[model samples]
Target chain A: MIKVNQLKKSFNDLEVLKDINFEVKRGEVLSIIGPSGSGKSTLLRCLNFLETPNAGTITIDGLTVDVENVKKQDIQQLRKKSAMVFQNYNLFKNKTALQNVTELLIVTKKMPKAEAEKIGMEYLAQVGLADKANKYPVTLSGGQQQRVSIARALALNPSVILFDEPTSSLDPELVSEVLQVIKQISTKDTTMIIVTHEMDFAREVSDNVIFMADGYIVEEGHPSQLFGNPQQARTKSFIQQLNEKH
Target chain B: MNFDIGYMFSLIPEIMEYIPITLFMAILAMILTIIIGLLLTFMRSSKLKVLNYIATVYISFFRAIPMLVQLFLIYYGLPQLFPVFTKMDAVTAAVIGFGFKQAAFASEIFRAAFLSVDKGQMEACLAGGMTKVQAYQRVIIPQAFRNALPATGNTFISLIKETSLAFTLGVVELFAEAKMQASNTLRFFEAYLAVALVYWAIVVIYSFLQSKLERLLEKPYRT
Candidate 1:
């Protein structure tokens, strides 16, 4: 489980996340759907300390840290507790797909090479990329790279997995393959916070859903309740716009 | 001055004796250059004000001063400033001078290469639980080294030619040996011409090697 309180982040004069707070229970799937510039990605990044919060506190799996007064050890613990799947896939360009997953296990977790390779192969197989394990990120398609990234995140077995617009950067034809991987992952008992624009996918997969706009959570409820019978005018209008576009 | 083809051909054996000396200085200088250059690069990129300032000043000072003057300073000025340096041989002084000067230039190439890597790579590495050092070692630096290969190769080739300046430090490398051969035989044309030819031939061979190295390093990154 994760608990974030009084989280606020600003880039100089422009405030992105304004005193936001949220939580997800163990094995829960929380999908955050919002328009662009809603601070969804920024909020996700702040959770892992990738983008340091100006003021906040985050607790994950019994470990807590005051963001303003954080030490090096706190950041390391936070990073170890969480794994991120980037929108860009961000696979190590020089490393093959197998190495991408095995690297973290071997280097950070201190797992033996043989054990890491075994788990790495298992995760690669899960993502349906076992055949392309030897190919570098440059040679892999965007979808394949994203799946490899997912395998890498899964290999770490972190307390939470953060997906930041995993399908947003892919071509339309490629988006389904990545979304299918996420769909497959959703069936497992994994805690995930996905920042996505796919309204239908968010409704189909997420147990809980939150609508955000202008750095504020406008509404939160069961996806069926929120998507089927939304309360806030903004949430309804935002969903309407997405529906019209689709 | 008439070209002395026969005499130049005759001097080949004598000049060949000094090839190792030239290569030793160049190879040593290049090794020093890479180490010092990477250190300076890290310093220049660091967030600390004093460290960044020191690296900036060092790069400017070494780059602004001529290579010949730098050689003279390390060889002549060091001994004057500190008596301990007087015992340091000409070869050591030349290698040190060339190393520092080439490091200044090589650091820029490395810095640019480091800058060219995608910012997301580091983020992904850290999110995967790697410490800063691990991320750099496993992700960032390897990619940066690949990007830096061609430029670093150029730096090595120039370093080899720059060893010719060791003649001024009383180190009898290829150029110094040719100078003595010229003075002794008074066939300055043949001796200097042969030296130029040797340098050119070495450069041509190195260029071939450089291309091969570039291709090898480029393999993984190319789609």
Candidate 2:
């Protein structure tokens, strides 16, 4: 389980996340949807300590960290509990796909090379890229690179996976391939927090959905309830704007 | 005096005897430059203000002054500043001068290379449960080096040419040998031309090796 309370963040004088709060039960998929500059991505990054919040407590699987006074060990432990999939598919450019997946296991987990390779290849197979293991990321398409990143994240077996707009950077024709991979992962008992703009995918796969606007959670409930019948005026107009654009 | 092609050819083999000295100085200086440059990079990148300031001043001073001036200072000026330096030989001073200048340039190259790597790579490594140090060792530095190869190749080629200055300190390198041969034979034109050819040939060969190294480094990055 993951829980965040009174999370507040600001850049110098401008507040980005204002007293935001949310929680996700184990094995649940929670999707955070909002317009641009609504602090959705910042919230996802804060959970992983990529952007430290000015105030809050993040608890994951019984380990908690106060945002203001975090220690090195706490950060490492918190990071070990979660893995992130970035929008740009930040694979190690110098490494082949197989090596990218195997590096963390060998470096962080201290697993034997043969064992790590086996698991890495298995995850590559799972992502339908087993044949491309020898290829470097520069040679792969955006969709394929994102899949490799996903495989890399999956191989670590973290308690939760935080995806910050994983498809936001892909070309239109390539979006489905990556979304399909995430959809497959959502079927398993993996806990996930996805901040994305893909409303249909979110409505289809998410167990709970939160609508954020200007750093505040305007509405929260089951995906169908929130997407089908948004209660607040802000949530209604936001969903309306998205539907109009579609 | 007319240029004598045949005499210059004859002088090639004799002058070539000192090729080892030039190469030895260049190789030693190259090694020292790499070590000092990396250390400077670390100091510049460190959070300590004092270390960063010192590294900055060091890079600036070495880069600002001419290589010849630096060589003279190390060989002639050093003994004046510190009496112990009176015992230091010209060859040692030449190595120190060339190596120090190369390090300044190399530090900038490496620092720029490290900056060229996307910031996302570091975040991705951290998210994978790797420490900051491990991320740098395993991911960031490797990619940064890839970005730095072409510039580093240029630096290395320049270093090879710059070693010619050592002859001014009376180290008897390729140029020094040619100078001596010309003084004896009074064939200044032939001797200087032969020395120039040797240096040109060495640069060409080293450039070829550099391209091959670059190709190997770029293999993984090729689309």
Give candidate 1's whole-model lDDT. Answer: 0.92
Q: How close is candidate 2 to the true structure, as a TM-score?
A: 0.95
**Candidate 2 local lDDT, A72-179, one digit each (tens):** 889999999999999999999999999999999999999999999999999999999999999999999999999999999999999999999999999999999999
CA lDDT of every candidate: 0.92, 0.92
* Regions more than 4 Å wrong, model 1: B1-6
Compared with the true structure, model 1 gives a TM-score of 0.96
- TM-score of chain A, predicted model 2, versus the true chain A, to 2 decimals: 0.99
Provide TM-scores for the models: 0.96, 0.95
lDDT of 2 by residue, B122-162 (tens): 99999888999999999999888888888887887787788
Clash pairs, model 2 backbone? none
Off by over 4 Å in 2: B1-6, B42-52
